[model samples]
Target: MFQKIQRFFDQMIVMRDARGGTEISLELATAALLCEVVRADHSIAESEIVAMEAMLKRRFSLDEQALDELMELAREESEAAVDHYQFVRLINEHCSFEQKFELVRAMWTLAYADGEIDPLEEARIRTLSTLLFLSHSDFIRAKFAAKPE
Candidate 1:
């Protein structure tokens, strides 16, 4: 019995290591990208955070705590990132064009959360949208689609 328990624990450890330190999901990575865009303007308001959390929860079907964990991990990764290319590549490899557009839409929602658009935020969003292969028109449509009615 003791040997069996030890083997089980050993297997668990191996599985954990194989999965890496943290299995940052594609959705979490996408959320991190959106967080980077919202924070680019250097005015991360509480409203924006709240709105982001809500959107992440709804979009990913995550519970509040899970969403919070995802957001926290995303923020840390965003801060550590040296450039946007890594994120763009990850998104491109993992997401479809429509999903990328939805990401841009989420960024737009966060940008407009405080009822005013910051110029820096807009610029970052534009750059990110372009990197994601979304045209100006598609980005605009995404923004409109995510707008609060």
Candidate 2:
């Protein structure tokens, strides 16, 4: 599964390079997964877009131009993706437990950005939590941590 993902990301890199776009990185993978959350409900909300931009900028410390490029690349990759395993695999390889926990929090936060969580959005996050090897309790914790007051 991961080998297939590696090949896909490799092709993505080559395609992005040929277009003179920013190279793929862990940041891009993370961003793309967040994009997946945004697209999960089949209705893109401006608030979710804003939340994703803010979260990505703060997390990656990317400047405006770089952030824009990354978002575009992420969106394209998210759309073209065959599955979420690629993004999750890279993150699992690189991130610590705390980092993965925070990522789940971020996904929850994005899911609630529009003031409600669609079932589809929650389902996506649940799938991600399992893929990330998070405990069921930790998944609930992350959801509560990111829930708007």
Candidate 3:
């Protein structure tokens, strides 16, 4: 467990050396936000997990191994975080409006993955959208775009 934790934190170095610094950190930040959405409902559904994994994979172009590590690191980061500002700051600094919108959409998808939207989940996404400097229109648009058919 200790070694795992050490390796998890070491991901920054490994990923930075392997890829580049900003990309991996951005991925971590994005994943942490997704983790927040996953936990917003206070229930971790399997569908939510699957949705998160798929979104992360698609967004980051991560293979299974990297995806798994990112998911684990993000979960730990989210749990340890005192607030969302750190993650949001990193994302806002690095991501464009389109990228932020995509992230909000993914959050909505995760919120709806359990077959329903929880109030807490909605609130979480709303707050995140605002923090990401997105307008109400953007929020609503993403919500609808991610709404299940």
Residue 108 in model 2: lDDT: 99
What's the CA RMSD of model 3 in angstroms?
5.3
Per-model RMSD to reference: 6.8, 7.2, 5.3
- TM-score of decoy 3: 0.84
Q: What is the alpha-carbon lDDT of model 1 when measured against the actual structure?
A: 0.76
lDDT of 1 by residue, 77-139 (tens): 788766776667767877888788889988988888988888888898888999899999998
Which rank order by lDDT, best down to worst?
2, 3, 1
lDDT of 2 at 141: 100
Q: What ranges in model 3 sit over 4 Å off?
A: 1-24
What is the Å distance of residue 103 in model 3 from its true position?
A: 0.5
Q: Write the residue-wise lDDT of candidate 2 on 28-135 in tens digits.
A: 889988999999999999999999999999987777877787798799989978788777887888889999999999999999999999999999999999999999
Instruction: Please list the residue runs of candidate 1 whose C-alpha ends up more than 4 Å from where it truly belongs after superposition.
Output: 1-24
**Model 2, CA-based lDDT:** 0.85
